[model samples]
Target chain A: MRLLTALGQDIRFQFRHGFYYAYLVLTILYILSLRLLPESLVYPALIIILFTDICALGFFFIGAIVLLERGQNLTQSLFVTPLRLHEYLLAKILSFLLLSIVSAFLIMLGGSVGGQDLLWFIFGAIFSALIYTLFGLVFAARARHVNDYFVKSLGIGLLISLPILAYLGLFDTPLFYIFPTRATLILLDTLGGDYALSEKLYSVANLLIWFTILSAWVYQRFDRYVRHPV
Target chain B: MIRVTKLHFAYGSNSKDTLNGLNFHIDSGEVFGFLGPSGAGKSTTQKILIGILNNYRGTVFVNGLDLQKLTSDFYESIGVAFETPNLYTKFTALENLDFFAQFYAGETRNPNELLEAVGLKDAANTRVSDFSKGMKVRLNFCRSLLNNPKLIFLDEPTAGLDPVNLRKMETLILAEKARGNTICITTHDMHVADTLCDRVAFIVDGEVSLIDSPRQLKLQHGERFVDVEYRDGDSLKTKSIPMDKLGSNDTFQDILKNHYMETIHSREASLEDVFVKTTGRSLQ
Candidate 1:
């Protein structure tokens, strides 16, 4: 109850005029990009196209929001409230999860990507958002200042992207499956419901593991690390 | 009431303890002042008391409940106004109050009434970004009362305000004191400590050098003499005389009966001078 009440205000604040505009502009831009994508993705290079475009963009946006909060000192304010540490970690995942799902689904729908595959795309985008949002929180918490945050985040992003981007030339078979980008491929190919038992098991297990590790770090270290100097 | 015994807390594995063997108790309804220069364990002590900083080696009891034993319920009994105004700039002052007030299990006072007390009622509808530093400080003052707390923690509560607003803040603090609220104020400002604290602890270099009531501490260290000023043949002259010898001193009698007295004032130490005397460090 304490956590919900504290987070409610922050969630609502994010939906206010200035914040809402930013969210809207990002959503519109994403949808427009989908509309303008090469039709080749709808057929042949679907997995490559999905991993590179929507999933990547959504993760980048999540990082941007976390970095903004760090810059504005909202994270510090949230730290001082009578909230348990895990509550914030959970709230961020849940809030961003819901928002990105709605965002990804709308863009896929408006761009004429239809049927059950669209639902899977939304689910994939949500998983990717959760993973990267946690990643961004860890980085933002570790950063000493806002400018340092951006420079370091961009560096981290480039390093994480290296192998993923190399998939275009380095592999004859689908390489996205080794990464959580597998979810994005499944969604774009509309293969979520069609995937085998072992594949489903792998996706679920990896998601759970990442979430557990990130949440534990949040509980143990995030509070002390981000407490502003008095 | 708050009690801390042998409290020890450090930032990291390689750092020394910020709070080491700290022992103190604040009785119910007492206004306690923590006076220290920058980084002198003032904030560390306040954070420990407010449940913000944890993992410390200590036995801390507040309102008869152990600090570690209690959970979110501990926050319900106390209010805090940090030195920096951490308000939602996008929201109106009233909206900010309304949002935070919902988190408390305790009955909250009306936001408007508290804002009116601090002279921000007319500005309630205005966005917090539009408020000046003093206005924001007033808003923070209103925030501390919204929960109707039994204990209040105010850090540098009057640091940036002008003299007029500073007096208003002092009066508002007195009003809280009148209502039997135990307040723990942290500041490097000596005047705020002298005028408001019932008892103040002079913290210098992570240690408490002296702790006593402002008046009592002033009297204990003040000179036992009075400086008498009078105009003698168009020249202003002054004489320092021991207060005990005034009953038999002819010069004192002559001054009282003969020449017009320019000024008569008791020579007593300010709390700042007392702090310097005890700690050998300025309150800055």
Candidate 2:
């Protein structure tokens, strides 16, 4: 019940702060960009867009949100309430995930893509958003300002995006599978259909493993840098 | 409702301890003030008690619960107003209060009533970004009471208020005290400490030098005399007479009979004077 209430406030806060409006504009642009592409190119383009941008919205947004709250010293007021740290983190993660899911759904619909595997698409969106958002929070916890967060996150973001080289066929190496984005790309590829069940299972298991690892790292960093800052 | 013994805290392994062997206890419904200058461990103690900064070598019990073992439910019974206004700038006064009110398990105060009590009813719909510093401080105070908490922690609650608003804040604090709520105030504002606190602990260099009522402190440190200002012929003159034998003092009687008395006042030390004398450091 407390988590739901916190989530409600977080969503309202995001809405009032223009997160919804920003996504509305961005999603429409993504759809328009995809519409201009040739029919043969639409599926691959859509997957690339979803993997690189839509699913990663939380990664960029959560940093701004957390840093803004920190700058205002709102965390001190917030943590003093009955809300636990995990609840607070889940509320943030879920709120941003809602935005990412809605944007991905609209983009796919407007792109005239049909026969897509809706279940896998959503699973990919959820896992990708969850991992990236948690990843962003780790940096956000240690950053003193939004600019600092972005500067630090950019380096980490580029390192994770190395998997894109293999996806684009520019560099194909088995080591690319070590990055969580490889699992995200594989799951998101299911939207194009014809993906084997074994690969889907591998991606699901891989993402879950990555999620568990990131969750632990996020919890420790947030507890140290945010909850008990010196 | 709060007790501390041998409380010691340091920011880092190499740094000096910020709080050193502090000992104090506040009774239920008592208004306890931690009076000290900036960097004197006043806020550090409050944070430790409120479960914000937990690394300390001491035992602190708030409502019989250990500080180190506190759970989320521990916050249900307490409210804290930070020294700075730490509110959402985009949120309306009402929205901010309503948002926080949902976090508690039990009954909470109505947002509108809390705003009205703090003279913020007219601006309830206004975003906090538009509020003046004093208004934000008032709204922050209102947020602290939303839980109807049994114990309240107010840090420099009246730092940015006009005289009228400051008095209103003081009156509201006193009213809360009357309602059997224990309040711990951390501030260097001596007037506030003198006006609201039942007992104040004078802290300096991480050590508490004195703990007593403001009235008692003044009496103990002040001279037993009264200063009289009188107009004599062409100029105003002043005289000091011992308060013990004023009625029997011939000079005081002669001044009242022969000259037009302008003003008379008892010579009592202010809280600031007592703080300086006791702590050997000014509040500035």
Judging by lDDT against the true structure, name the best candidate: 2
Cα deviation of A96 in candidate 2 (Å)?
A: 0.8
Name the regions of candidate 1 deviating beyond 4 angstroms: A1-4, A16-19, A29-77, A117-122, A154-178, A191-193, A227-230, B13-17, B68-70, B245-249
lDDT of each: 0.73, 0.90
Docking class of 2: high
Candidate 2 Cα misplacement greater than 4 A, ranges: none
TM-score of chain A of each: 0.72, 0.96
Report fnat in order of the candidates: 0.17, 0.81
Which digits, one per residue and each the tens of the lDDT, describe model 1 over residues A1-230?
Answer: 76676567656766763545675676677667666668755433334444554445434444455555555555554554455566766766666565555655665566666555455445555666666666667776676655666687767656555544534455434554455544444444454237665655566665567667766775555666655333
- How would you encode candidate 2's per-residue C-alpha lDDT over A112-160 as one tens digit per residue? 7855467876787799999999889989988887889999998998889
DockQ of each: 0.31, 0.80
B-chain TM-scores per prediction: 0.96, 0.98
TM-score of each: 0.88, 0.98
Model 1 DockQ (Cα-based): 0.31
